[model samples]
Target: MRRSLAALAALLVAFSALTVGRADAADAVITDFGVQAGESDRVQTVALQRAIDETSAGGGGRLTVPEGEFRTGALDLKAGVELHLAEGAVLLGSDDIADFPIRQTRIEGKVQPWVPAVLNAKGLSGVRVTGPGTLDGDGKPYWTAFWKRRAENRKCTNLEVHRPRLMYFESCDDVEVIDLNLRNSGFWNLHVYKCAGVRIEGVSIRAPHGDPPRITGDDQPWDEVSIDRAPSSDGIDVDSCQSVVIRDCVISVGDDCIALKGTKGPRAMEDEASPPVENILIEGCDFQSGHGVMTCGSEATIVRNVVVRDCKVGPGVPVCRLKLRPDTPQRYENLLFDGLTLDGAQSLFDVKPWRQFYDPQGMAPPKSEVRNVVLRNITGSLRSLGDLRGNRGDSIENVTLSNIELITDRGDLRVGEVVGLRYVGVVINGDEIEAPDSE
Candidate 1:
């Protein structure tokens, strides 16, 4: 048979030339002696920190940020470095927030403060920030000093507004951020605390859509329009770490594209009964910025097997968000959102128990809990007016809905209590939404 198909095409070209020579021998080409493109940000941050401390003093590799605009100021990634940014590169920053200082670390995941960011990395193990270039923080005066410290304390937290986090990985393990494109930040673009085997692939995050990044001289043009909700400028903030995986990304930020938090306020149930953020996985993503693409608790602490399937949501954010925080004894059970597709959102399954921005004399009244959730095969054509409220002493239980096809303008579904809801073969608006054969 033609010599067995030419020996299986020469063994797939010798395994693609040994996987491109082991990725060019684990890479380390810092523009051949560093600091080149329109130089002198103090000589390219001192020749890129002397080629990342001489490639971690001869051990680790992959630092290559080749292409263009490379301004600097604060960049301290090491321990087997990996910051590859080719293809029209631009790792610009240095709008000077005292060049990002003040670090004790672990912001959302309680450790008493953190600030040093503009790309900070600690305890890294095989770290990586892949290409398709652009990690610009350049955050308009740290988002105008974080809304002037929330116009002076709107129950401050998120480390009292001392910004800078477009990427901050600490206690890292096999971490990987692939196909990058992160923009305008001052806070939360990606802040994986207490990391584990993490992988955020095919990324493309862009902030500011529909007025939220304005706190300019507040004279009430609606208070100078401060829509950039400066409290976790989210796109990704999965704190209290675990084995995470966010795939096929394309987020549009103003806040929450993926937010499951933990650790804060009155000791967050001893940090959720000891490091409890289980196997999380989000699939085929695409949400044009801000508000629930896969959320849980406003400051989540105990989350379990979360799996969000094939997604693609667009138009005026605010869909499928479960941010129940009645004071924080958090627990969200094995959640799952399967094959989803919503175009033009304004609402669709928003479970709320968020204590109106909690601050009951410094919090302590939330015995948080969201049970086994599952929303299967949902196909929406929504436009607005939706609400699936829950919180009459907590219980958004074993929610299961199969083959759902909704066409909304507001109607077809709304319940906070249907004994924790469930429906198979639900086809709203075409009529067929039943599920009570037993709980």
Candidate 2:
């Protein structure tokens, strides 16, 4: 028996060595390529790309960005490489649109021709971006351009405005982004598309808080504007990804804090059988300001086994939201929200059919299904209890709520086209609502 145990230990050590051997070949430094700060010609982009390429070519290793402001365009990350940004370092994005070249990428759940992100990684494995510094997207120019276009066309969709994301990882596996401050993005801050085993922890994603500053080229001054000028600047968007764990992050942006979406458009849906986004866990996150702390789809095909717990959401944001667009075929099920503490949020739960940019293209609107949701141990002060109104041919099913204590002046629970709802020990405004009829 002792000899057998020794043999098992030897096998375990060999497996661990093999795993580590596949990743780190050697440690490479970025300073070897003359990547220094305060260059007169701003040739940091070329230097950085050369560093990444050389490191990848010489067998992957760690590419360390030392303490300085490195302004660059789109830098593609490679497999078995770790981009480590040290303290006092800042990776600044170039303001020129020419920096980010156009590529065939996924945007808003549909694969289309769009500009790549400032930092992009695709089809790689064992990639990591760890930092104690910041990634600042110089988004003022993009914001000014978008507002100008909006002034010309008041009814413009998000697609109409051509903006680049801050960081995007596509079809990458075993990714880790930790302890970084990603701020002031042109569009969506961090987007993970068609990836697996992604873990984002201890990160802060922020856009401009209030009204945008007045630029010299813009005619209008966006002073005291109530609406967000940074349109569609979502904090983190997980699109058609699986096995994602986002925890210990502070997200405050103009759009949803975290959203999940699947393949969109009829053509994409018919041609490709994209996998559903499942097994997502978001916990221990602090949401300062956003649309919703956790939102699921205006373009999802199937989203299942999602849990958002142990999160604190600040004022003026919804705790949880599920958007069902009638034009997109979707199914959202097995979602759980627990141990959430809200401070004067707009609503506790919001599940409704979203009609923004709904184009059926001469076809009948598709129906959606939302089922098997459970919300428990929620203590909050909200304005409303929220709505659960499905579309005409669709309905919500098997929703359960328990141990919810909320203080709201109007406990308006609008339940329409719902089936098999169970409420237990729910207290709102000093009244216990044991059943659905008690409301």
Candidate 3:
């Protein structure tokens, strides 16, 4: 029989070199389904998440976390799983907060509940978490109870400090998280919700060196006070859901590196609940220590086709921010911030809306709107600057600032509108005003 078909093609090339070869799915090996290397096993991450929930309930595989040191706690990834963290693996995170527990997740989206994730993959479909190991969220007791409630209530609620997140994939589909490092987390450090064909490549998220915590009720008294302590730390929080593609990632944060959300309102457009975030694509990324390198909505609801191209922003954050929350039926349409490199900032763009200590008791306060925003080719330089307020009653209309070359030290450019508008390329303190062309 042709030597039994050449010994079945040499046993499929020795079972493809004992797993872990080229890709295209088909790698189902998990160190014999229990993974181990150098001790500290919480039964080896619960026997490798029960062998990836019994091989994705008999229809999937590939959940290997080889290499070493895996002091586990919360690692739940199912649905045709594919979490391979070989090459010196680490997966540590057990600073014990009940070793993590608090289900029904979905942050920034309107599920209003979280907790559970030191790497979680939910309601999946072809989910993946490639190699180049390390998913450590050993956040020193939730960064010491978020600085003891920011030294005693200066306004707190990151779920009242019970942090735990270093990878949270929700309502997923065809997801792929490549080359990882994802470190020090106790909250918000790669949280994607209601996903679809999402791909986050070459990741490297870090955290350490805490010294920021002030958050004191907003509504402009210097708007955002403190709250930058890499504690409830967020560095990639895409909510609602969409066809996402965040390329070559690298974020240094204590808050907001990329936050575009949706789904929060009178049940947020009810379509049987959920679904609002739209086609998002954040190109080649780079940001350092949070506060808007790319942020939108305060708790978004209808964000549109967002495309932030070739990026890089550093030093004293805030290159472009629009946190509208006049209660919460937000809408930031067709946003496109092209080829950017604002190497320093304090504000290049900021739209307002946050009705003082906002309260949408039963929803119906948010009438927030910011239309066709496009900040093309931007370069930067700014210090001790802030405020580009627009909301004399739901403002920020059809903004288009092209070839932005900023250099501000409060060098004025504070234009406020609301009376049949038309404002363009404004420059204050160096005057170049040309607004008032509307009838």
Candidate 4:
């Protein structure tokens, strides 16, 4: 184990050296471009873009935003550029949809038309966003729009509603996002798509707690809506990415704190020839008030070799989740969750079929598979042991639970369609189920 940790550390060091070595020598401050804080009608978008473009044109360097609230629209990032926000700096997103131009991007594993994010970096290398500052998405308008749309159509999907994300990085290499407070996103907070050698550290993401904002169209005030009205406010979503490391982050949002996904179905299968998401490492994180601490797949083609360790999940946060949609072809394997302390979660491990948006688009339904999952050294207070249900002839296989202690009201371990299930030193309320019943 020691040797394995050493090797991992060495690999991280090598990756950092390779990526950080490409940054330029000097820093370019945005304030030098006549950006001010006190003006009511001022939008820092143009000024910030000027700084980034000039820096990139002059051989990429750091574009620094000093301490102030700078309202901005979509700011496209360039290669070899680092966006640094100083302490007390707040990069506020404009609520107007016009500020975000429509672009072709990947959402839910398919390429489609979508509003560009507040900060977008595509096809870039050695890009970084680091600072103790904040990126506030100001998502109230978009959230209201989504609720109204849902009211009209009860079965509307996420893509049907138009909203912009906080930060979106696509097809980028050697990306690093560190020490930033990302809050109140209109959609997913941080989305890293089809990126490699990514490292996200010391980030804090939070959405509005309590109730969703109320719609004021029918004699109602917007701020009084129930918190449940907030939709798709995910914390960090890593989609079709490789060699990713996320550590020391505190996340609490309306949706999953950390979600991993791949291609949706036949379209993704035709585009890619290999696994979509692989070699992901998540450690030393705190999760609170989310759908799940870590969830895999509503649309995944192949996700393999993921490790989650040393995480603390607050009350009502599921430790881990695996979601398989019948319409999407998926293969999830070699996932490990170790040293997790969970509290008041609905379940410790949740594996079930997802049927929220079940449109296969006339394609033949494909068989999904989940195999080789390990849960070790987990201590938690959960509502139940959890459920593992899979389709017939496509069973979940080789799941091992070791050194687990849980205090729960109900210890019923629902093992449905699982093969080679093993439990070692597992105790639930001072009683061991011994052999879990499998169907």
Q: lDDT of each structure? A: 0.70, 0.80, 0.68, 0.81
| Off by more than 4 A, model 1 | 1-37, 40-67, 75-89, 92-100, 104-106, 111-115, 119-133, 136-180, 183-235, 238-257, 262-328, 331-367, 371-398, 404-421, 426-439
Worst 10 residues of 4 by lDDT: 15-24
- The 10-residue segment of model 1 with minimum total lDDT is 14-23
Candidates 1 and 3 compared: the better one by lDDT is: 1
Residue 292 shift from truth in candidate 3, angstroms:
5.3
**CA deviation > 4 Å runs, candidate 2:** 1-25, 40-43, 211-228, 266-273, 435-439
By summed lDDT, the worst window of 10 consecutive residues in model 2 runs over: 13-22
Candidate 2 TM-score to native: 0.89
After TM-score superposition, the amount by which residue 88's alpha carbon in candidate 1 deviates from its true location, in angstroms, is 3.2
Q: If both were scored by lDDT, which would come out higher, candidate 2 or candidate 4?
A: 4
- For candidate 3, what is the total of clashing residue pairs? 4
What are the models' TM-scores? 0.33, 0.89, 0.32, 0.92
Query: Whole-model lDDT for model 4 versus the true structure?
Result: 0.81
lDDT of 2 by residue, 372-401 (tens): 888889997988888887788776887878
TM-score of predicted model 3?
0.32
Candidate 1 or 3, higher TM-score? Answer: 1
Candidate 3 C-alpha lDDT tens digits along 1-439: 2342244335334323332222454566566665665676453667767777887787675767778877877888876667888888888888877877777776655565557878788787767888798888877667766666655675765677888888888887778888888887888888888877677777878776357644433333332233334575677888877767777788887778788776554345553445677767777788766778778756776777667778887777876688766556566766767777766666766666554345667655545666666666665666633554544356566655555556666654455653323334544335544544322
For candidate 4, the C-alpha RMSD (Å) to the true structure equals: 3.2
